[model samples]
Target: MVDEALRAARAVQSRLRDLPSRVVIYLILAACLFPEVGYPGVWRKLTGALVGLPVAAPTASALAQAR
Candidate 1:
């Protein structure tokens, strides 16, 4: 279902699929307020507190690539 929406919205990432575009968008939005925390930190806080992220927490490099 998510993939279908991604396809419809043209939001999907490249073929690597190491990270999904939607997740990156979510993190990017969240990062606006906590820019100092950085992507990995935001990821830690988000996964630990906010949404129970369905996908595995991406590495810092992967997160950067996703963005």
Candidate 2:
């Protein structure tokens, strides 16, 4: 659904960036999932989840821009 929405929104990556649109999308969803956790808490959770993956965790400023 998020992919579809991204497409509909015409969100394209024109340049190489640290945080991909998909990652930002999931971060937004995560924020909703753990409303009480706050941004920092959500970021910690995101970093933990990404530990086993090849993706790099986004910086706090980058995440804030995504929002």
Candidate 3:
């Protein structure tokens, strides 16, 4: 029982680790697919923000390095 619980916890942790990357990929795809609609300008701003130039380097670097 303990081993099974541990395995489940690890599995959950692993999936959580992957969630951010998957979300970012989905967001990028959405930006490409529905530009000028849902969040066209927003995605551009987000991309720019992530690049670590215009919006200050540290925060962008942290977000970029995440997941």
Candidate 4:
């Protein structure tokens, strides 16, 4: 899935950002799945299972700015 995401990101970032487009894409998709929860909650649920992996722990404002 991660590989797919990387491949899907054909566009490049204009500048260095804390959260990559792939992560934002998945995060938005996850938010759709769990609409009842806010971004912070969605982020927690997204990262909860992947405790072994290194992921961005972004803030609400950051998410809004990214989107």
Candidate 5:
């Protein structure tokens, strides 16, 4: 049905959450290029943190085993 197809499309769109991140980057670039728009401090910080995400460490035994 049309309704079911519509619902499926919406669900796929929702799962594509990366779109928001890309939009934020674009907005930040625009702000930087056009100083009149002002600085995108919040967006810059958010993107920076997202890019510099923390990595998980191996457990003590796991690390020793590799050594």
Candidate 6:
């Protein structure tokens, strides 16, 4: 649903060099899902899941700026 909403809003289409918008959106969703975890914790969890993927996790600073 979030993916669809982002797509509808054209939020996924961007020229940014770092941190794809979809990744940022998913990170936000993950943060919501694990409210007990702080931002760093959420990022660790997200990066864990992303480990097998071809993409690299965004830095903490990049995530903050993306938000």
Best by lDDT: 4
Model 6: lDDT of residue 36: 88
RMSD of 1: 4.3
- Every candidate's lDDT: 0.76, 0.78, 0.47, 0.79, 0.42, 0.75
Encode model 4's per-residue lDDT on 9-56: one tens digit a residue. 755466777787777888889999998998889889978988788777
Candidate structures ordered by TM-score, highest first: 2, 4, 1, 6, 3, 5
Model 2: number of backbone collisions: 0
Tens-place lDDT per residue, model 5, 1-67, is 5335546556323444423333434544555666553343433433465655753333334322322
Q: Estimate each model's TM-score.
A: 0.65, 0.72, 0.29, 0.68, 0.28, 0.63
lDDT of 1 by residue, 21-44 (tens): 777777888889789999999888
Tens-place lDDT digits, model 6, residues 1-67:
8778888887776576556777778778888999887666788887776666776656667777776
**lDDT of residue 14 for candidate 4:** 66
> Would you list the rank order by lDDT, best first?
4, 2, 1, 6, 3, 5
Candidate 5 has an lDDT of: 0.42
Model 3 lDDT tens row, 16-51: 442344445545565677666444353455556466
lDDT of 6: 0.75
Best of the two (4, 6) by lDDT: 4
List clashing residue pairs in candidate 2.
none
Cα distance off (Å), candidate 4, residue 41: 0.8
Lowest summed lDDT window (length 10), candidate 2: 49-58
On residues 1-67, what C-alpha lDDT tens digit does candidate 2 reach at each position?
A: 8778878899956777777787778888899999998766787888885666776666667778877
lDDT of 4 at 17: 78
Q: Over 4 Å off in model 6, which ranges? A: 1-3, 49-57
lDDT of 4 at 4: 70
